[model samples]
Target: MANYQEHAFTHSGLLADIPVTLLAKPADLTAMISRFGNLGDAIDACEYWYGPYPYDRVGYVLTTDGALEIPTNVAYPQFMTTQTTGNNRGLYTHELGHHWWGDKVTPYVHNDMWLKEGPAEYSGHLIEEWIGGQAGLLQAVKDNHFRVLREAHLDDGGFQPLSPMPDEHIYGTHTYYKGASVMHNLRGYLGDELFRQGMRGVQIALAEQTMTPQQFRDSLESATGVDLDAFFDAWVFAPGYSVFVVRERTVNAVNDSFEVVLNIDQKLRGTTVYHEAVPLEVSFLNAEGEEFLADIVASGANALHTVMVPFEPALVVLNRHNRLNQARTANERTLIPGVSFGSTQPFVDMIMYQTNLVDTTLVRIEHIWSGAGVDPATPDVIDVSDTHYWDIGGLWPEGTILRGRFTYAGATADNLDNALVDGDETGMLMVHRETPLDPWAPYPDQTVLAGDLANGNGIVNLDVMRKGQYAFAKSSVNVGMAEVRTDLATVDLFPVPAMDHVNVQLDGGLNGTVRFDVLNAAGQLQMRTFRSANAEGRYRLDVADLAPGAYLLHTAIGEGTAVVARPFTVTR
Candidate 1:
């Protein structure tokens, strides 16, 4: 027989009907009983949606094993009760939530584990909001979103659909985090009442029976009378999240009214159509600083609309309330909904995917500049043709090579030379300068990727190893001659898409003792080593143990930290 202390907590009437019991070592009886309120709170949250805890009694057994829903009881790890890094109550609510999804109704097959685990996981975040507040919930969602994006960047697992999961990844991020994300997205999409009714009805109907995905879908459909097939396809069956951007928004004054014209773009992470049309909000402020809202539904890849407002709007923005799902995180205007972008594609006038300048971390490119921010005089060699400038500023290390595809589409400014309305990239060259004081120069590795002179559409692949003023000009202009950086030691990694090991090459500027660090896509340090090298040398880094995903190489020269991060990937 096992020797253990059993503590019964009626929870001062909180769980009087469903008396809660905790069994653990004699030394921990007092601590377990003190935290018994977590269970009561979980029951309240679950019952609020699922109608009540299905089990007659609440029970938990403290063990070394991770938390699990074992019918009437939960096998909870001892450390979770005092976990400071994460929500400890979340652990409680998750297992107790399973009492409604798993204990009451089981999945017909293990493949359908998402049905129970996903809702349970989603409930954990909801409970955080329940006991704490919206701030708690937001932090929880932010943590999950970053984890999902980073994991997806790690192995593309987070993008996979919930059902038919690979044997090894059935319990992975897609099943739990994405599952929770979809639930949150649906709640926002359906509004609280419909989503609650749909979920509560489904949970009740599937009681005491094996549940399937379709069975769950049918119940929700019957309850709401809103066909959910499209929702399910885009969110559940599909492997990627919907990506939408406010491509263009223009306002013009009419007789006693303001007409607002908007152009919206949509693209799935890995596909074409975004089947579900979640409600999109456009907020406007008038002269008196009063807010007026207009709602639209995001339908497909491209949508254009005109709305009439009663007064001239001072400003307009998308999702002012931040009511949409938090499937990704952002820095300022950076809103990356999926994997980290090493090879970033920033929509000129759209949201950013926070691209970390120091590493290979995926980030959104935000247009954080305004016309009056820093107007520069014409380049030293401005031809008779009108020349325009686009400001660029962000973090960068000494000798870092910044290369990317510069794409310009959609005509905003009517300046003829400002766009490709009818011009061509004949001698068209990409130029940059550290600031307005420096001379403009041509960046290296310039190749014409795409050019549509007629549509004002074109893309040029080029590299500018430093952050500065950039502009497109003809070859007739000669501001400064350049290929790449010639400053501080430049670091470059070789054997891109590396397998066994990768080589780090140093050239131009670099010498003395150097600190080399490796970081996963999430920006977590994976390995660190020191090397003494000449101004130009090579060092080998073993990456066999690292998972196949995006990574960054951080090199520091001498006592001064000159961070030059070059992204590399590992493969099996």
Candidate 2:
């Protein structure tokens, strides 16, 4: 036997043998004691609630190794202690709980292992509650419930019966999570005192001996004075679980309290639905700073229950104990929207418009606006005056449209105004004619548009034609506008080769309203017009769906244009 030691601790009374040889560092002495202190508290709580401690010596080891093993005694790794303090405490408590469920009354065969593991896991939560209050324990339980539901698979053909221990790393199933869930459900059925008594009775009856899986079940029945065969058969022997889909819920006021009625459906998929009643705790918080609690049991495929509680509830949350896995929750939020456009203008315009449509609470927008030589604030609007080109930069979901329109007026009949669009980094150009001009006409002479500028300069008036298909050129500028002659501004697209998404930064212009357009390899539009004002930030364009090819993104804010052309490939 190990040498035993007694010491005064904050959480529990009576400290047991300390095996210092297992501890590597001298500094770990205090930490080792602290860990054992928590373990002592758990043992005390379990004894007070259920029964007595069954171990003569508690062996605690701190190591950097990964696995948690029980070799005729309790063994814990040091990494657990340093990685997560709370998880370390819970793990120690759980392993210690095994002294009763696993070590004292061992499983004769590997199949009956859950009888040892499940109860010990549940005991860990109980200890967590004792140490860190009910709220902290409840949150831990909720996290575990979500993890189980998220990992469970409904298409794994055969169900893994809880009677036998399956390979731990098998795909589509996990033993520890399922076992813990089963024990939690049992606790709901037997009530706190009855469950504790049942566990203690099993430990005392089978003390210092090993039992088969069937024998463990028999002991549970004898201790609880109830038939749990059906419970075990459905939850333990069976595989898979039922997902509850809540269709609707209604709350009504009745006699100084509120009564809630919920319409729910169960989807068992390929598995048989178990006919069992599960306790659900409903919490309602009212605007008047009042809280109410109600308990209800859901048993049938289509179960309806009315829960009455004092005060009207502003918010309602179900499955407060995290005993059962739920498919739907009221707190779920919608995923981000994906939009596709057919043209660059429409795509850029859509992006700008949807910027406002997106829920501000969920997404944030950043952008930059730039144009040709004349500092975006003063863009030349004359025909072929490259000054009117605009570039808008920001991140948006793939296949989304960004749309925006700018107006320009001609200063003379010979000089016409036009709009040219292109991506910032790609340099792929798409030009559109602003006014109805004869396509066969000669190139227009030097003329100014309607904007505040020097004697030879021109301004782009906001008056735009609302009808007719505006002819636009792909990858080139259109020189067919009659009587329009102006110097085109030379803008360079940077960060040439981009993977996934590209960024556009405007160098010479005041930040103003900007728009974006995403085009596919074939120069076809996939999203509608998106727009944002004075926005400056990096924008991501998803090229995952696009084939191994090149794509273009055009950005424009006022008369400034920056084009970005990038090539990317999709790998499955």
Candidate 3:
């Protein structure tokens, strides 16, 4: 518990007719009252979204360290000088949000603390978004989501439900992060109008009272005229997080459109069955360029769903914005060989690994090319535990046959890359047309062109030109082809140690709009701009006004998944 000194200077301001005051120590009197004016505006912002401030007098005290909200007054640690106040304002807004959520509509018991903390935290993020725009909101959400995920990974004491208050020591992320995420998702599920109406209704109905999780859900349902029982049960009362993967896929082309069938598997171990209304944003791509966007939903385990698109999709991306709370984000999408290009010719990459419990260290990796009147050739033998890359040009064209065989030294050897064939084990093969930008796991939705076991020796029979050649190799191989088309690696930006401005030059071969986002060292978006590449695909940027410091420039070409990141500095 913290005690405030009685001897202090006070300044008063009107927060939309609601009297507000700032109390501070003698030495800090000037800075406190100066930034106190912004507190008034923060109150106004909260009131605009959450309705009127419940307390008549809002007082904030600047103290030594940390902060706490006690009814009408909040104790803040840092003295707000003009230079630092902008960064600390979020704390003020969050504490002020408690005036509505914590002080007025308090939770009846400790178990329901989410009613107090969840909305307050979410309000803080929402206020940042409102004040700073979409970029700010995205940064806030990504930061929070990453924190929650870190916490989730660290919790080895086992899972607990997010309601009725779990044990205090184990109550960190589930209470603050998971709760806030639930509110954020609920708002998305309810839409702007209904979510706003429901939130306002909850505030108005519970003012000067306490609410349990059920009561809050009831108020929202009553206001929005929608049944959210499933939503509450799975997200709020559930234990484990939702993890989904694409188990299988099938694609069929019809005229200018293609039909996609996806089998999504939800693998959350435990006795609890987690139900989710998975929101998906699908991006369709073709030779004409980035085509269009479509939204779809999948639910439950083994969610088999089909979607039709207006264009022949060269590539399809799911959960583009990363909206789902996926435990294993890998295998979210797969390339349809025949659909990516209207050809049967196969373009493939493979990784091979030697089994740990092997009788011999030597292993042979052989690729057999046959078909289209091309005679089958002898297998190329490569012996190693490390990564190897192979490129077969026009000889293995459309309708060509390709087979990958791994030979173990001994006749009793179980498999070519013999060992326990689990996702976690090495010697597992993964196929990809080109190496992905991010690590193999986090961005697994679309990497697979075709995959086969190293023990079985992978096999693929090319369909037509539309059916592309596939890649196969042992999993965990960090190698990619050097010839993959894309200027992601060749993107050039300078002056490295720039004072005024820097320029970014892309290969004229790179077509489409490139979004450039510049951020400070703290990962806060400093400036966001874009440039469009004409036929030749060339563009540049002017970054002269940025402050002198280290910064990151994130470049995403067009609407494609390819992104290039580079760090630069501005020196005085």
Off by over 4 Å in 1: 11-16, 34-37, 153-158, 254-257, 285-290, 320-322, 326-328, 331-572
lDDT ranking of the models: 1, 3, 2
Off by over 4 Å in 3: 1-15, 30-41, 79-87, 153-156, 247-257, 269-271, 285-291, 322-572
> Per the 3 Å backbone cut-off, how many clashing residue pairs does candidate 2 have?
88
Q: What digit string (tens of lDDT, one per residue) describes model 3 on residues 488-531?
A: 64667777888766777665665544555566787655554434
TM-score of each: 0.59, 0.52, 0.55
lDDT, each prediction:
0.61, 0.47, 0.53
What local lDDT score does residue 98 receive in model 2, on the 0 to 100 scale?
76
Best by lDDT: 1
Q: How far is each candidate from the true structure, as Cα RMSD in Å?
A: 15.8, 19.0, 18.5
| Candidate 3 or 2, higher lDDT | 3
Winner by TM-score? 1
Off by over 4 Å in 2: 1-37, 61-73, 78-84, 152-159, 165-173, 212-218, 225-230, 243-245, 250-260, 284-289, 308-315, 321-517, 521-572
